[model samples]
Target: MMNIQKWLKHLSFASMAGMFLILVMGALVTKTESGRGCGDDWPLCNGKFVPAYTIESFIEYSHRFVVGVVGLILLATTIMVFLYSKRKDAKWYVGGAMLFTVLQAILGAMAVVWPQSSAVLALHFGFSLLSFAFTLLLYLVYTRFGGAMNKGDGTRLTSGVRWAVWGVLIYSYVVVYLGAFVRHTEAVGGCIGWPLCNGQVIPEMAGGTAIVFIHRVAAALLGLSILTLFLFIRAQASRDSAVYQAALYSLILVTLQILSGGFVTLAIGYDIYLLASLLHAMLVSFLFGVLCYLGIASVQTAERSSAKAYAASRLP
Candidate 1:
């Protein structure tokens, strides 16, 4: 039984890493304009089992292959969780991964066979991000075992702090989607500068410029929101607590995310922008995952506190 559990842990970690790869490769496909590299084909690249020799076809086909393989691993991990694990939240994480994995694949297929609008294309990335987040959360669950709640050396979070954590998590997803929209719409050029749009605090709200500007404002707010949440969590929880550490990771990632946004702007019109773009996507993916774990830690801490209080009241 112990060996089986250990194997499950390894499998979950692999699935998590594979999902991360998919996210990076998906971003690569978009940045290189390789979405149509397979020429409107699904499951097969350019109507062949293996695509012809072309950079675009290779990227597109590789992404498809990785998604298919990782998806199967995720499915196996989910089935094992149901068969062997007893945690209720474990199911939620794996279930989310399965659901969004399917949705992301369908969206990718539709984009190829039907050529979706930019808004729809942006959703493809959002779905992929969610899938990656769930897989990451599942890995965290397996590695931590009895859950981070068991290490409750920290103080329970206030209702306000809990709300703030959940709120920021949801808002960060919105900011990510806006960033995806900017990519799909090719609106990066509209801004032309980081921390400023066309050399102004507020540029003309029209066309691609408007889209980029909105994403910028949204991202800036997300940074501020995360910073506020981190400080609040630190004040309430011990520095060594899971909740506090998660918040600290969140703060660091958001800071890097903001800096990467600036780096991307500076690298614009240069080939280096591709690397910068990938860095941006990678940071956001981890940031979202960390925030999800933080939410879980917050709820678990609250539940632990309530259990203790109830037990105390029952003491005679």
Candidate 2:
């Protein structure tokens, strides 16, 4: 039984890593305009199991292959949780991963079989983000498993803290979707500079520039919201140390995310192209995962807290 539990932990971590790869590869495919590398082919590269390879085709096909493998591992991990654990939170994390993994695949297929609008394409990345977030949360469960998992932590979160955490998490997702829209619509270059569109605080709110401006504004607001959440967590007198620690990390990650955005802009401005885009995506991914952890941690209720405490007193 112990061995089986250990194996499950390994699987969860592998699945989490796979999900991160999928996100980065998907982003790279878009960054390099490699989505059509397979020429609208689905499940097969250019309608053949092995097709002529171009740089684009190779990158796109590789992403598809990785996604296929990652999907299997994620599915297996989800099933293992159901079979071996009675934890409702574990099941939810696994279930959410399974559902979104399928949705992400379907969206990818749609884009390949038939071209989608920018809005639809943007949603593809959003689904991928959600699938990745849930898988990471599953890994978090095993990593933090102990007294906290067995009996709810004694700390009780207030209604306000719950609202703030949920609000930040949801708003971050919205900002991420807007960023995806900017990428899919080729609006990234519309701003031409960081913190300012061209030489102005606000550029002409028309055409692609308008979309980029909106994403920037939304991202700024998201950073502020996260900062508010961090402050809220710190103010809790008897808060679980986990929540305080996660909040501190959240504050740092958001700052890095915003800074990475600026780096992306600088790269574009100087034509000194690099993986700044990938770095930006990575920061957001970590930020989202941390947010999910806090959201789960916040739900540790006090109703059962006293019960657990009383039960502990009876323990020999």
Candidate 3:
């Protein structure tokens, strides 16, 4: 049983890492404009299992290959999680990962089969990000709880803090979507400056400029919201609590994300922009995953408190 548990832990960690790799590779494909490199082919590159050599085709096909391989790993991990995990929430994490993985794949196939609008393309990235988050949540749960039904630390956060954390989580996703929209719409060049959009407090809300500016504003708000959440959680939770740590990581990632955005802006015309953009995507993906874990931890803490209260009331 101990061996099995160790194996499951390793597998889950691998799946989580693979999922993040897919996110980064997907961003790479988009940044390089290699989505159609296979000439509208799916499951095959230009009617061949092995695509001809070209930088664009190689990148697009490589992304597809990693997706297929990691997808199978995810399937195996999901099955093992359900079979071994004694907790309901553990199963839910794996199940959510499976669901989002399939959804993202379907959306990805559709994009390849037919040219999609920028909005639809952005949804593809959103789905992938969610799938990554679910996988990460699954891994974190397994490592923390060992797939057992252990009661969590009964540290109850204030209702206000709970709501604030959840609210920030939801808003962060909106900011993520807006960022994807800016990328898909090729609006990165519209902003033209860091900390300012087109050299003004407000740029003309026309064309790509508007899209980029809106995303900038949303991202800024997300940073402020995360900072507030970290402070609130710190006030409520101990240094060792899972939610406290998750909130800390989220705050750190958002700060780096903002700085990475500036790096991307400065690298706009340089070869390094591609790397900068991928780093930006990677930070946002991890930030979302940490936020999801924080939400789960908060709920567990609340449940533990509720259970304690009920038991106290029943004491004779």
Candidate 4:
């Protein structure tokens, strides 16, 4: 029989991986414009239990099928975490993962049944991102509680680095949402040229082009912020290698994200662009998870420092 710890470990990993794949498949559904493949009938394809085997129906149904399976995995993970992890933080993180997963699933279903505005539909993707990030963190917290990974040195983050990590994280979400909005609104082709829209930095600020241009600008600022975060973490590399490595990983993801964005532009509306777009989604998701982990580490360090100072004060 598998030990409970081992069972939970495998479950957590499976849940996280499943969520990540769901994220990518969701992107595929959007890029392929297969949302309506089931023809306004959800949980069933066109009023039938089985889909008719058309390309659109197959993509859409496959996505739904995957979501159903992942949902079960998430349910199991949540139950196991509460059963095994008595830590307050562990419970909260796992609970949040379960909550957002359900919320995202509901939002996706609503859009399928009732055509929503672009803004509302865009939010559906945002929730998917949140669900995935939280689930990944759930796995991390689970591992830490089990004493599986090496606990990093007790190094407190300077206020500057701590704030930088958080700032970049929240800003990344805004940039991600903007990108989703571009896709939902069919504004991806608004900027015809790579980097610059229509060979102009400012492309008249009219129609879908304006939306695309603004997302590009926001993304540029996001890149700069992550670079600043990386520098701050690197400045204290000797103190805590763990935080530094997390920052380095964030840097790599953001760089790949930017490159993928450019490729997405060039390959817009083509089957090849689908791969680039999926990469873009996955990079941002993992980047957000890393930033969250760094933030949590900083808090843990601060708490430890406070305890040490209190003990020393009492020593006198």
lDDT of each: 0.89, 0.84, 0.86, 0.81
Q: Model 3 over residues 224-279: C-alpha lDDT tens digits?
A: 99998888888888887777878899999999999999899889999999999999
Error of 4 at 104 (Å): 0.7
Q: lDDT tens string, model 1, 1-316?
A: 8987887788889889999999999999999999999997788988999878899999999999999999999989989998897767778888999999999999999999996999999999999999988888788776753368344544699889999999999999999999999999998888888787899999999999999889888988999999999889888999887899899999999999999998998899898999999999999999999998888788888788888999999999
Cα RMSD (Å) per model? 1.5, 3.2, 1.6, 2.3
Candidate 2 overall lDDT versus native:
0.84
lDDT (tens digit, per residue) of candidate 4 on 33-63: 9999999887789999897889899999999
Model 3 misses residue 9 by how many Å? 0.5
Candidate 1 regions exceeding 4 Å error are 149-154
Clashes of 3: 0
Question: How does residue 235 of candidate 3 score in lDDT?
Answer: 86
- Please report the TM-score between candidate 3 and the true structure: 0.96
Q: In terms of lDDT, which candidate is strongest?
A: 1
- In Å, residue 129's CA in model 4 sits off its true spot by 1.0
Which pairs of residues collide in candidate 3?
Answer: none
TM-score of each model, in listed order: 0.96, 0.92, 0.96, 0.93
